[model samples]
Target: MATGNKEIVRRALEDSWQDPGVFDELISSDYVGYDPALPEPIRGPQGAKDNFKQYSDAFEGAHITVKDQIAEGDAVATRWEGRGRHTGELMGIPPTGMEIVVEGLNLTRLRDGNIIEEWSNWDTLGMLQQIGAIPSATAAQTR
Candidate 1:
């Protein structure tokens, strides 16, 4: 069961963001997401799609690589790194054509093999700095 749970999360990470319908298969209808980037709780598969769509739309070649994963007692935690080019608008910031890499970890809880909730922590500020949306400390220091 632990391995099955882990596989489900892995498949979702690989396919769900781009194929919105995959969320329905992987995420529970009552799924809720907790993340600093989210303005409110994510409810259901559509919410998951919407959350991921922001990144997918912004980065045409975006891809997430799973660095590590662990599963226990109906829960799975995944550490991942995502990289891509800034080819479109993201969170209202226009594209800067910068290649960016962001690392994050998520802990997902499952109910009957479906993701019921997820909590994520990621380097949002670092991404912003990489895309030049915000100046880095070193860049600021030089001015």
Candidate 2:
């Protein structure tokens, strides 16, 4: 049996890669992604797909590497790094031809190989600035 931690991580990566039918194969109907940017939690598989699509569209050639994952029953905690380039429009910002490497942690709840809930801690603003979307005038000035 795949441990809950392993299964959840596998599903999360599959979803991130924008694999067709990933959600249908591994996610629950009432999945809730605890991302700060979304006004409301993703309510279903399609909503989850939308979230993944948003990410995949923005970060082309994106890759994720898991540093560590620990499991406690149904919940799993992970530390990971994801890297990609801004090859297309991302959050209303056109391609900047910049690459971003982000490191973050996430905790997820799983049941029956389906994702139930997740909380991700990532540097959103830092990622934006790295990709040259956010104004880095202050950073430039400081430098």
Q: Give the number of the best model, judged by lDDT.
A: 1
- Which residue pairs does candidate 2 place in steric collision? none
* lDDT per residue as tens, model 2, 1-143: 33755766765764457574777766789877887866787767788788777778887888777888888888888888888888888768888778998888888888877878888888788888898766676877987
Off by over 4 Å in 2: 135-140
CA lDDT of each prediction against the hidden true structure: 0.89, 0.77
